[model samples]
Structures are given as structure tokens and as C-alpha cells.
Target: MLLAVGLAVGLALLLWARRRCPRGAGSWGLVLRHWLARRWLARAAGWQRRRLEQACKDGPRSQELLLLEGAGTPAPDAATFRERHPLTRHSADGTEPPPSPRPPLGLWALLRSCCAASSPLQGSVLYLDVLARAYPEALSPRGTARFSWARGCSLPAAAWPLPSLYCAPEAVGAAPSRAAALYVQLLLALQERALRVLEAGLLSELYDALATLRASWEGLAQDLASGGLSPHLELPQGLRHQLEGLLAPDAARAAELRAECARGWDVIARRLWPRLQVVVVAEPGSEQLYWEALQESACQGLPLYSPFYSAAGVLLGLNLWPEQPEPHYLLCPGWAFCEFLPVEPPGAEGPPDTVPLADVREGQEYELVLTAQAGLSRCRVGEVLTVAGFHYRCPLVGPVRRLSQTLSVRGEGVPEDRFYRSLRRAVAMWPGARLVDYVCAESSLMGASSGACAPHYQVFVELQGVRDLSEAQRYKLDQCLQEDFPVYKSFRLKGSIGPLRLHLVAAGAFRELRDAVGTRGPMARVLRDHRPLHFIQSRVLS
Candidate 1:
């Protein structure tokens, strides 16, 4: 019994050691270290290594030195390396001898050597070549060609042929025997190192390139400002001419140069900048110039980076553009409006007492209230003002009192109160039938003969039912909708609303609410008012 217990304890200890050292004892680690050192030592003396050093001195070239070194030539240079190994390289006759196999080296060691090498460019090129060889089938023809070129080989226009040489210990040909074995080993080592260097170097280069491009752009912007390029793009021709004259020495007679710069900027902006969409928020009936500029920017692929409307754009361009909105706050001068009291005049001492009419106050806290006329019939102009301790006009709308309108299905004017009331009534009729969501799709009719308004609205409704309803029941529901909803009736009579449709949601449509709030209750309790519920409701209902 004691002997059995001893055996069990010994087994347990062995298992624990194995778990702690997955490579099996320190022996494997030591072997790997030894192999790495041997490979590096071999590489240092290899022809490929010599060639790589030569290429580094020569500056950037198409040949991949690292690949040549990894392929087997001692200190191999990119210029001498071919696409295929000697064994793989074949003459038209297909009588080439099999290439000698080289021992595999760990990736980590190879990378470390390449990165630590003397030449950054050569190191990068060599590393990329090795990576391609290690995963030969994974790369594309273009990728393979690129790898070869970077290594220093000027490939012939024809398709790559098998290598004519081979490393063999017992061969009866003109091929060198001992040299072949050495070459194969050297090649493998070089390839391993090249891969690591490529990975690290590529990332570094990408970041550096981006930074340089951004700096260039900023410098150009400064030059343009001094040269008199107005930020507003509304500068007079005389001023612009003077600015052009000032920039004549550098930019004159070089329209194409400016265009080239713009193209370069566009390329970086499109390929590297984070978010590209630019959104312009303006009052209804506002000019379209802003939208045009935004569209132009998008076409150039340097999309307008606006946060208010381009949330997806922001997320997609997270790497390149500022994720937040540009001009995060707006400033409006107080003289522009009479709705709010002007605490102080322009250039007044101390912080403007009240607030300048048109000046924007960043980080200022204010309450937003939607006030209606006495009868709650119409939203009065200047009614939606901000209130800190005192009332202030919102900078977003300027001083203009813009009235908001709701469109009926038939393009008739529908009061906001009536629309909300109809929705409330619908919910009341069937306690189980809840009016969950809504949206208005805009349309327009052109030409005077059309007798239609410039803009039209189509309503979409989301309804929740206790149980599933048949098509016939849905028709009845539509009728109920028309009768109870004034907007629906007006739309039907005017042919503004194409048709009435019911979007029925599943019984568990409120599941999302449960998931979000970690509990179940009235959805209204979870989602704040004014949030777009159409999308969420549609998913639940469907």
C-alpha cells in the first residue's frame, strides 16, 4: 500500500510538471534556443546575408534579399534569388534533381534577427519574402511577384519556372553537394527572420506614412491660409488673386501640382482616414450648398465627417477621422435675434452677462422645452428656448422662428396633437394592441401640372398584438386605423399615402427592453421619448 501511494504521488508530480511546461521539461526550450543560435550563426556567414547587406547599401530595389538568404545562398542578395528553389526550378526537359530539405527554425528567432538587422528596408523586404515562402500557397500571384521583387529579384516577364539547382549529399550530377545542404539551411533561417521583420516593419511603415501625410496636409493648409485660401470658400477674387500672386513662386504654373496634391490627400483621406461621411444640419428650406459640399467631399472619398447624422461613418472611420463632431459647439451673435435678452454687447468686459445672440456657449447647461401656443394648437416661433437660470435662444436655430409641420398620407397638413391622439386612441381600443413605433417617409412631386406639394410624408406604424391576426383581421385593423386617424383619412382622400399597411410585431417584441433594462415593464419606462423605435420595433415584430 505504501509503495502504491508513492507511485501515485510521483505520477501526480510528473503531470503537474508537464502542465507547467508544455514543451516537455526545459530540454525542448534549450534545444530551440540552441537551434536558433546555430541558425543565426549560419545566417551571419551565409551568402544571402552578404547580398542583403549589399542591397541595403544600394537603397530600395525590387529584389528581395531576405528571400534569397532564406532560400539557401549563404548571404544571398535579392538580385540573385529566383522565384523557385533549385529543386523546384525546372528546365523545359523536367529532369532536374530533387532539392535538399533544410531543417525548420522557429518563427520568433527569425523575426528577432531580421528586426535587429542593420538595414530597415532590407530587413523589411527579407522578412516579407520569408513569410511568403513559409505560406507559399496562401499568397496571390501578384503577392508572390511583389515578394520576389522586394527581395531583389528582377523576374522575367514569363511565368516563373522551377529552379535548375538542387542541394543533395548523394547526387551524380554537376550540382554542388555540400554547398547545397548549407544553402538550404541558410534559406530556411533567412525566411523565418524575414517574416517577423515584415510584420513589425509593415505596421511601423503604415503608421509613419499616415503621420507624414497628415503633417503634409496640415502644412499645406497653413500655406493656403497665408496664401489667402479662405476657410469659408467665399473669399473675393481680388483677395484670392493676391493670395495666388503670393503663392506664384511655388504654386503658379502648376495647376496640375495642386491637383496632384489634392489627389494625394484624397487617397490618404479615403484609404486611411477613419470616418468619411460629412453631415450638414440646416433648417428646413435652407440652401443646398452645404449638402453639395458634403456630397463632393464624399465623392472624393474624403467623406464629410459629421457626427449628428453619420454615426456608422464615424464607427467605420474610427482610425482616420476624429470620431467626434467637428465644431462640437456653435456660437451665434446675440444681435441676430430678439427672442433672448442680450446680457452684454459685443466686446463687452467680463463674460457676456446674458449671452451673445449668435455666440455659442460650450459646456453650458440648458433645459430644452417644447412650448405650444395657449391652446396647444400650434408651436410658436421662439417657443423652444433654453433655460438655465434665465431663458436663452438655442444657437442651433439662430434667431429665425421656424414652424414645424406634420405631413398626412395625402400630403395634407396634420396637427401634431391629432397624430399623437390617434396613436393613443389606437392603444386604448385594444389593451393588448400597443402602438409601439412610427416614421415618416418623405416624397416630392415636380412640375406645376402635378398639383402636388413639394414634399409628402408616408407613415409607418408598428403594432403589438396579444395573438396573431389573420389577413382579414388586418384589413379590419386598417379600416379602424383610417377611421381613428385623421391623417390617414386625409392621405387616402388626397392620394398622398400610397396605401395603408400594418406591421405586426411578435408577442415578445418587448424582449429587447427586458434585455436592455435587465427587467420587464412598460417599454416607455425603458426607452426615452423621441428616440427612434421603428428599427427596434420592426425587428421584434418580424
Candidate 2:
């Protein structure tokens, strides 16, 4: 009798809770899974913090003492570890580290945090769909989510209703068009409530998506009103079927988009996804140019959020407060033993001294170093980061650039940031022009075909709102470069360097090049050796 009564009461409570829950919000099992995942993450983070503290405490001891004396193992410390293990750059160190054992919870936490927003429940279009399954409320009809890459993602059945598109790796080329179609389809199906654009390619890809939307809005509006997929979008059969189902005849929404489309490209994102709250991007780095372009164009009025920073199988840091404008990452305490080597002058010899994370000062730039258990010794990731400020005890780092990608034609050795600034200034001088994508190559790579007698820089740019450039307009970039570097100016004046060559390509040239090259990473803005034939052949403006 007692058992029967308990079962009856539990069943009644469960049914009542189900009735009260929002439609598609998920069952009690999902709530339990979310709770477990969150708990595991907290524990993993706590373990790492404790390990870091212990390493510091035991760091002063001799290596001999640490190895021989079981009772006196030295505490892990960055400075002492640096003294023993020399720094290794990834390019120079070609061998992989032996698999190092990881605490189960720590490994799980690292995997869970990949492309995850600092707060998953509320971040639309920036949150990963796999995690969204653990909390169905994140996939509720009120909002949507986006992935940085769907290549490795295994989207469970639960994410289907989230109103976001996940293209299989095979369909990467058609993604922009498919994404545009899905955006319009959702806009029609959900009406005004479909005001979220979920995407995760950082700002550059987002800019491309907006451009595609502008090009296809009229055709998409027609498709939505007719309850069918746009013929131009080459999508998988299954995905096409799923998308077609949402294309119910929504004439009113179609008309709404058509009217908004007339307002211009600058107003497209805002007019379409007016309720979009936050923009999530990939690991923050030298993306300020892309961010500014986005701000001036489609992503106007949207708050930006960068949740956590990780790369090449390492969990680097987390942004505890993404509400702030400038993206800052708080270094993970337990992931790896951390150190920062101060950035030296261009010709500085040997490795400079390294400082522990605690010693990093505000505004100082440093290259990150890590000593971890994986047969990995002290490895310099070659990524330079600036200490932006701090969140409590941890340093808040903003990425500057990769050490290897700097341009060095005529030994000017201009860093990525400087070149980006010069290009940005040149773009600003041109009226009605917006930069889409650009790549720089030394004239030596292209030889005489570059149209320069001496060594120079061959720049290819894709621009919007500009067709042909007068010689004077193209010369502005050379002038800006000289202002940034006296060395380049001297070489040009001495006839040792040829005039900078600029080529304008068709709008989608770089996008096609990216697909052709394979998306292991974004096309290098500066190419050191070979120039892709796709880029050379696609030049439209003489």
C-alpha cells in the first residue's frame, strides 16, 4: 500500500510538470543531463585551479629532488619548469607528443567546452547544437543556435527544431546559399519570432552570409510564399526535404522581407534578425578589421560575445564576462602549465626570459608557452597575445597574431597587425568601397607576371561597391604602406623594390578559393611561398 501510494504521487507530479513545461522544452531526463554536464565542468575547472596552485607551491625544489625523493615531489611552478624545459615552436617541432593521461573529468570538460558559449542557454546562433541537446530550452522556438564548423559535429535528432542549418562537410561550397534559404524559410515559418541568425564562422563568414542573403532575398521570398526550396541551393536530399517542410506559404512574411530588402545592404541583418541579441565568434585574434567591416555593414547594433579560446587540442582560456566589448580570455588554471615570453624586437636573438601567468602586466605582449604531461615539453604555440587586463587573479589575454604569418618582403618584416591597419586605412580613403577579403603575396612568388620589375607585394582584394580603380586610387595603398614603414619607402625610392600591384577580383572569388583549398584554416592573408592559381586566375580588374 505504501509503495503504491509513492508511485502514484510521483507519476502525478511528473505529468503535471510536463503539462506546465513549454512545448519542445524537453523532458525531465534532459534537465538531469544538463545538471550533470554542468557539475562535471565545475569539478574539472576546480581540479585544474588546484593543480596550478600546487605546482606553484612546489616549484622551488630541484629537479633531482623531485625525481628521487618520493616524499618531496616539487610543487609545479612555471619559472622553475621553464629553467629546465626549453621552449619549442610548433613549426620546428614536427613530432607529436605521446598521449598524456588526463583526469577523466578534465578531459570531458575540455571536450564539452569546444565552441560552447560562456552561457549556452541564451546565446542564439553562436551556441553549438550538440550541447543544445542537453538543454532543449536552448533550442526552443523563441531562439536558435549556430556552429563554427559542422565537419566534426554529430547533431543529434533533438536539434532539428532549432531553426539553424548544419551543412555536412561535403556541402561546404553550397553552405552560403543554403544558409540564406534557411534564414528566409525560418523568417517565414516563425514570422516575427524568427529574428535570430545562428552562425559560427567568426565575422568573415558572417559577412559572407549577409552578402548572400542580399543577393538571394527576392528569390527566397518567392520560394517561401510558394512553399518550396530555391532551385539554386544545392543541398543534400534529406536536408532539402527538411527545409522544404518549413517553406509553408507565408505571403505576409515574404512581403515584409521584400520591403526591408529595398532599404539597402547595411540594414539587412538588423531588419531581418532584429531580435538578435549577441554575436559569437571563433577564438579572438587579429579580427578587428573584419569586426569593423561587419559593424559598418550587416552586424550593426549587435553585442559581441567570445566565450572560450581553444586551439589544436588545447583548452586555453574562458571569457568569464563576455558582456564587455573587447574580448578577453581568462587562462585555464589546470589545462596546462602556463608561461608567457615577452615579445622581443624584430631581430632579437634566442628565446627571451618567460614569466608565469601571475607576473603578466597589462598592455604587455607575450607569446604563450605550455609545459604539459603529454610527451610534450615546453612548447611555444607561436601565438602572440597581449595582456588586456585581468579578471581577478588570471590575466585577460587578447590575441595579437601568429608569429609565422608576418610579411617580410624586402626584409621590412611588417607584422600582421601593421599591414592590416595600412590596408584598412587605404580602404577607408576609397568612397563607397567595403573590403570583403584580401590576400598579400611577394612579387617574387608571382615573378614577372606580377607586373613589377623588382621585388614587391602583389595584393588581391575583393571589394563591394567599387568596380574600376584609377591609378591614383590604387597608389593610395603604396602611400599608406610607406607611412607605416620607412624601410619599404626607402626600397621603393632606391628602385630595389617595385611598385605595389593591386588586383580586384569578382565578389565570390575568395570564397571559391577557400572551398578549393579546403577549410583546414582560413586562407592565409599573407602568403610566403606559392600563390594559389585560383586567386591568380580569378583577377577581374586590370
Candidate 3:
């Protein structure tokens, strides 16, 4: 009789709790899901660790030895490394002691070690009909509780919804569209290095890329303005307000930017993925994928999504959450067989050149040494990172800019990242007018009375299309810029500067310039950080 009573009470309690608690939601759900994922992650980490350890122990006999040998560079731990002038605080020698001589890792191997998971083997098709199996009511109204899992993670308003062309609900780039493809092409171009942009052979490719990007933009604009498009996405309320003052046709609600050729969600999804497609169904000779998609995108009028990762990754600095990975890039002190050096003010002997992760404090900057794995040991790759904080013995760093990317005109320093924000402000001022991309150069202006010349800022812009600007528009842009760069303001006030000048380049000018330089997209992107692009002048059809 006692057992029967206990069983009855337990059943009753369970039923009552189910009724009171939200289905598939509440605090319990979050914990349960995380527990499941962490279990898998732990298993994966163990698998990786075991393989790495085996390779370390086996030396020449390891099956992975071939992979290690391909490193083809001087061992970072070799005595020669010790012979180099010592500059690190981490060690009177420099960095962590070289790993047990088992073997060094190549770049690809190092990248793999850093990755959380290998590429998925499964096909890319979303097959919603099939996915609905376990949740037969997934699309039904009652399934609202099914997606409560979304509330678990959040992104800041700035990155919550991307400015992408609308992505398919189930999968990224399942079907090819010019709008979607153009974004990838643009991204590839953005990553290019400056030297590659000036190369002689890559010129035609650059022209083709720029033209396609423009055409795709025009076509996408038309589609967004059309009513009742399912895939079309709108900017979140917060981001919309931020860009409204600069965006044209200025529609805050009701697909306003698309209405004029403008281009997210409460919970952001990775929509820029190309599914299994390199970019929505790779074609023959995708070796030229960037160029191919760009050409197609120029002709298609489809609406597309923005590159979610690129923009979101850059803005990760806005992250306010605790425990989530802070905005950062990694430094492989040993992985690349590299070294890091301290950056000190000029004329004063700097402190210890490099500090170990455990000893590194916040606010100090360091220069990265790369390509030692590529056999260039003495090279300092120009990457500068500021220590934001520490993750245990590992330092969490925020990237400033490559040394080559910083600009100084009359000793008013402007950093690439900061200048980018100022440009966004200028974009906001001319709603309906788009600032596609721009170039800045130091220009010489003759003084009117004294016949003396001075250096001033001359900005050449390639807008979405040619549009006339009123005096107010120009001054408004200029004023917004002064607020953005404090040092620039002081220079202007001190009469050490000439008036700012803006030049509107002709349509297809950038395309012509890109082609003439024969630079690949990746190399071209490198040019973006550099203080100026002399190649850009060839395309200045104005």
C-alpha cells in the first residue's frame, strides 16, 4: 500500500510540472542542449589530441610524418632560433620553449588543429520535407515552442541581421543566383593583397569583377523593392536606425532600402554559406570562381544576402556578452614557427620585446612574425595586435591594423579600422546615394596668397552610380569625418591642413583600374589597408 501511494504521487507531480513548464523551453532546455553538444565536443577534442600526441611520439615512423616534413622550414626550436638577437620577455630566449622535437606542423595542419570540426560529409540539400519527420508538426502553429532554442544565444543589434541578399530559409546558396554569388566575389576581392592588385596579369580580372559587382547591385535593388518577395530580408530596427541617416530612399520599415536598391533577424543565422557549393553549384574552371560569379551576378536581377561572417566577424568588437568568445584573432606563437615583438614609442628603448601569454597584460601592442613555417624566419609580417585581456595563459588580442594600413598625412595618424567607421558615417549622409568603395591619397594644394603648397586629404570615391552632391551634403560628410578623427580635427584647427576634397570617379573607372593592375581579388584586398592605391588612379575615369 505504501509503494502504490508513492508511485501515484510521483506521477501526479510529473504531470503537473509538464503542464506548468513551457514545452521544449524553460531553463532546463538550455542546459540540456548544451550538455549534449559539449559531450560531443569533448569526444572530438580527445580524438584530435590523441592523433597529435601520436605524431609527436612517433618521429620519422609516424604516418603523419609526411605531413610534418612538408613544413620545409627551419625548426622554430633549432639552436639558430636562439642565436637570433633575443628580444622577448616571455623568455630571455623568446616565446614558449620549442615543443619536443617530434616534428613541426605545416600551415594547413595548424589550421586544422584550430578548427572545431572537419567539413561535413553529408549532402547540402535542406530537404525540409524529410527534416519534418521527427517533428511532424514543425511548420504547424503549435510548434512555436519548438524554436524557443533561439532564445539561448543572441547577437548585438549591429550584427544581429546581416545586410545580405535574402538567403533561403533552409540552406545557404542552395540555388544559384547572381545576387548571392556577387557577395562572395566581393569578399574574395576584399581579401586580396595590395601587391597582387598591382600585378600586370590580373588587371582584366579586376575590371570584370568590378563591373559584375555594379550590375548585380542594380539588379538586386530592383528585386528588393518588389512587394511580396519571400526571401527578401529587412534590417533590424536598431541597425536600420543607425544607417537610416545615410541610406537612400531611407525606408526604415517596409523594405525601404531595397525599394531604392538597398539591402537580417532577432536571432542571426549564417546565411552566406554556399551549402556544399563553392558558391551555389560550382561550374567547370571554378579556379576562376570569383570572376565567373561576378559576371553572372552582373546580369541577374536577383536579390541577395550580404557576407554574414565578414561583417559580423569585424563587428565582433561590439560583443557585450560574458563567457562567449570575445572579439579576437589567434596568434600561433609556435604553430607557425613565428615570433612576436613588442612595439614601443620611438627614441626610448622598449621594454621586453615579447611576453608570454601568462605574463602579457592588457593594453600593450605587439608585432607578429609570420612565414617562418614558409622558411622566412626573420620576417615581421606587419600584423599588430593589442592585448585586450587574457584567457588563462593565452592572451586575448584585438587587431588594430597592419602597419602598412595606417595613414599619416601631416602626422595626423588614421587607422584603417577607425577610418572605416568614419566612412560608414559618410555613407549615411547620402541616403539613396551609395558609396561603393573609396581611396584616399595625400594631395598637394597651392596656397592662394603665399603661393605656398601644403598637404591635404583628397578622397576619390567610386559610388554605386554617378550622383551629384550638394554643398550641404559635402559639408555634412566633412563634419561627420571631423568628429570621427579627433587628431584630424586638431590639424585642421591648427591651419596645418588644406580643405578636404572629394572627387566622384566615373562609372567603371574602378573596373578599368582593377583590370590594368592584373591583381587578384585577395591581393586587391591587401591594397585596402594600405594608405593608398596608386592603381586606383587608372580607373578614375572622372
Compared with the true structure, what per-residue lDDT tens digits does model 3 show for residues 457-513? 656676763377676766665576689877788887787875676667777565444
- Model 2, runs deviating above 4 Å: 1-84, 92-142, 147-197, 226-228, 238-252, 346-350, 372-376, 518-520, 529-533
Q: What TM-score does structure 3 among the candidates reach?
A: 0.44
lDDT of 1 by residue, 50-98 (tens): 5533432432221222233332342253223222222121111211122
- TM-scores for all candidates? 0.21, 0.73, 0.44
Note the residue pairs that clash in candidate 2: 48-334, 55-76, 58-75, 125-145, 125-146, 125-198
Candidate 3: Cα lDDT at 78: 32
lDDT (0 to 1) per candidate: 0.30, 0.58, 0.36
Candidate 3 deviant stretches above 4 angstroms: 1-83, 86-328, 341-352, 362-365, 386-392, 396-398, 444-452, 520-535, 538-542
- What is candidate 1's TM-score against the reference? 0.21
Q: RMSD to native for every prediction? A: 32.2, 7.1, 17.1
Rank by lDDT (best first): 2, 3, 1
lDDT of 2 by residue, 161-263 (tens): 2222222222232344434433533334234334343445445555555655677778767875677866666667776776565446778777877888888
Better of 1 and 2 by lDDT: 2
Error of 3 at 47 (Å): 5.6
